[model samples]
Target: MANATRSGNYPPLKNTEHDHAIGPLRTVELHPERRRNTRRFGICGRIAAYLMSIALAAALLPTPIGSETAHANGACRTDDHGIRLTADATGESPHFTSIQFLSASTGRAAGNGFMLGTSDAGCRWQPIYRGKLTFAQMDFVTNSLGYVLAGTSPEGPAMLLRTANGGSSYSPVPNGGNRFARIDFRTATEGFGFTFNDSGAHYTANGGAKWSKLPTPPNTRGLRFFTLEDGWAVTLAPGGYLVKRTTDGGRTWTTRLKASSAVGVGGAVYGAGGRDVWVLLYGGSGMSQTSYSLFHTKDGGASWKQVVSNATAGGGPAPGPAVKAGKLPGPAGRPADMATPDSRAAYLLAGSGAMDKLSLGRTMNGGKTWRNGAAAPGFEGKLTFPAAKSGWLAVTSLTSPAVYATRDGGATWSKTFAIPAD
Candidate 1:
């Protein structure tokens, strides 16, 4: 199962003017009574002391704060964002690690041993399933059909659950001895179950009732399919990474792109219909910062152009290309979560770590122009947008278990719902 508490660390900010790190400054005495020296001063000495006090007070003035959140009465408030979606729904609270929406009003949220369904844009959520199983992966081919991969541990014999009434209930599907680490559906009745590592895969044509062995390219990480016969995969090549395309349902493959910097596909491949597709590629190590590249293809991977690339260390493609010269936004730290609602619109939550403040980068013209804005504190984990202007963010902090929503393309957000108490 996915852990919602997983977060990236924010890098220390640089104060270019002072050539120092930006953080809490040394405490200064502003009140006259708090002064340590008790000796009375002469006329000239009093003037000097008064000037020094003025300088210190000027230094203590607060900087301009971001409009994303506010601090009042010793608490962070999001009142300016909007009204809450609804009061907290009562139920057994499960730590939600992932949330997906079919439309503005229909969706599902899942975590360890539980899943909840909302039909009215999170105004009300009903418990759909509860058990001693961790939902590792979830996919829905339609509003009334979906699947969840569950297992006792992160790795092992996973059980498949199928829901046909919009996640109102689920039933077990026979596994047929196929140990799958993940599953992706290209249609309601056709899908592929991928095993751990690039071992191979299992093919099912009748809604996962039975399966047969399917061959996979070496070092295959995962698969994204637009149809049963048209899909894409990224594999570990000898020198770097290789983007492969398959038109025969994984029966055959073709090399589409080769890169030494990109480690692999970063997140979900989004598209408008099946003609235009966009994917994010990222690489780098924990010890060093990494850059992400966004690629676009309007002819279904026939041709691709790198529209946006983040800057890396040493001015080289640390993982991707160097930042476009004044053409797009620069690095906002590693991409923690991203949502591409369509071919022309995308949102990226960029930050370094879980504790660091995250910035929201939005592009409405296919990465042509990006407006980077501030995100609310503790807004991390899975991010999704059912529409270009409607988005949801699940707060990963255990102490702040709430979900946020955006209606203005992530310019602002409001607390929409909260995980109920046990």
Candidate 2:
């Protein structure tokens, strides 16, 4: 590779500066399991749980599974089946980097120190793994099969871990120091790991027990493959970002999109498959915040459309990714975080979260349109939809780290359980 720049890989697309305007201060020490593998790029290391543990004495008990009891502060609602999410292994706060739902009733959250899994909605949760380091690019292909690219660096090759027991435990997949930015599986036995550094791209025909390199675009930064062969690549340009696609795995490439100034300033690329793809661009300057641009394609990369234009704030720009096209997020925030369950459904988070209320967005018809939606108590910090209208969402705030469920799409959310913090 010629001029490759190191970005991050471990599903590590959350806030780089967790120190800015963080929630109420309460410090806690990290458990011995919290591991720091040496940050590769500019990714901030999650040293310890940001805040001390809140008084979780009342929340540790098992509440009624389906009963919702409104509590004080209008913040802490305890229902039957309520469980708590913790911040990594620190057991301090429940702030998390990634949250994914394998099914409407099953999901997981990755915090600074730990990874927790739930099956009975949010009613209860079990610790899947309690170790050091962060887990990014988390993907659960089935009820029992899952993959996470683990590392300390935000922008570099990360070690890959595989689980055959429904995220109960994860063991490293030997790629020999190969830095994988992301992992995608089209089937149970077929997958691809987009890489950084000299490893290039790889293909695993037998689940990830072994990997083989594929011919990939040089200096590729981000990889989003809809299938084993069909995918999109986010690379670097002189001024902004570059987009590429491959129909035959990484064996070939084609230029499909380009932005001199934006798709978004800090925006990213997301895809549901060959026909549905999105590029979020940031058009803001360095000083103040600005609105973002969303360029989407429902026809592979053959053509692109601008569904969302930019919105500004206070003569500057909004501080985060807000959905200005509708009233879902109001004017407080934009769509900063995104998760696409399929080409028809995509979820967006309203704020740069720590531990508070955030709005949510959902589009049921590709990226052509969106609807104002919300979750109970708080918005989703991390989300996943294993099936249409069937998803598990985790709201990892400092106050109450919990998961919720949406059955008839994202219109209504019910509490599953709360994540336990230290």
Predicted structure with the largest TM-score when compared to the true one:
1
Segments of candidate 1 deviating more than 4 angstroms = 1-94, 141-144, 153-158, 165-169, 197-201, 212-215, 262-268, 272-275, 287-289, 311-316, 324-333, 350-359, 420-422
TM-score of each: 0.66, 0.65
Give the Cα error of residue 311 in candidate 1, in Å: 4.3
C-alpha RMSD of candidate 2: 13.2
Candidate 2 Cα errors over 4 Å, as ranges = 1-94, 110-113, 129-134, 151-158, 196-200, 262-267, 285-290, 313-336, 353-356, 373-380, 420-422
Model 1, residue 401: displacement in angstroms?
A: 2.6
lDDT tens digits by residue: candidate 2, 22-53:
01212222243332321332233332211111
Residue 156's C-alpha lDDT in candidate 2? Answer: 35
Model 1: how large is the Cα RMSD against the reference? 21.6
The lowest-lDDT stretch of 10 consecutive residues in candidate 1 is 1-10
